[model samples]
Target: MKKNLFRSSSLILLVILMNGCIRGYTPDVVLKKDGQPCISIPADEDFFRRQKEFNILGLDIFQTGVGELWSRHYLDSKDHYYVKNQQCLYFNYKFQTNILYDISFFSTEKGDEENRKSTKKVWMRYMRIIKKSDGTLQLLLDKEARDYY
Candidate 1:
């Protein structure tokens, strides 16, 4: 009975350890124009007006790729693992719009040599703010994206 219990515990521990390195999603932070929450990266009225001087703001494109240089150099190399150009996002936040912020997602790592390669899955976050009414800013996690908008 003791042996069986030890085996079960070991299995559970293994599962937990394996999942420890996995990357997850960032919750959405979106509010109506009525304004409930404040903005984290705040700007001024002139900042808003200038941003609207142009009808089309700008395009923010994010490209993610992975693989060793040598492996990717060849026509086909099965030795390496890769995740390339996984996602692309385009958005515009005009000054006239009532949106306080626009948020996107990305994944990254810090202080880990083993994670040097860009092969790991990541969620990149993009945020664009139109205006901020209140001086207070709060970080929130929700179904849309995770940020303080």
Candidate 2:
């Protein structure tokens, strides 16, 4: 009985230790200096060639995928996060009840303008229009985000 208990405890301890050493916490990898999250907007080459029209209208372009992944540091523990390579575009359109679609992602009052601009480096892949009164979709910056994977 004593040997069995010791063996079980040892096995449990080894499992716990291995788990800790293996894949642990992952942080967020910020790929751009702008505060905008990266996403790939679906458009053809002509779309990019027509930057004058889109860019002037605040249209964003980019590729999609996790450029890298990392862990966010915490006081006691760490949290897993990722740097997604998706492009995001923001139009200078005002808030409209009818335009309140679910395919748009709104920007929150978090990072600064510089960070927001840096976020433009990365593009948004998809968008879920949040039903918030604010129509502004601010971007995230590169300096603000750190790359992991």
lDDT scores for all predictions?
0.29, 0.27
Query: Which residue window of length 10 is worst by lDDT in model 1?
Result: 66-75
Q: For each candidate, how many residue pairs have backbone atoms clashing (under 3 Å)?
A: 16, 49
The list of candidate 1 runs beyond 4 A from truth reads 1-24, 28-96, 99-102, 113-149
Give the alpha carbon lDDT tens digit for every residue of 51-115 in model 1.
21111111222211211111011112232222112112223222222322323222222222244
Top-scoring candidate (lDDT): 1
List the candidates' TM-scores in order. Answer: 0.20, 0.16
The top-ranked prediction according to TM-score is 1
So what's the TM-score on candidate 1?
0.20
Q: After superposing candidate 2, which stretches have Cα over 4 Å from the reference?
A: 1-30, 34-36, 39-43, 47-52, 55-88, 91-149
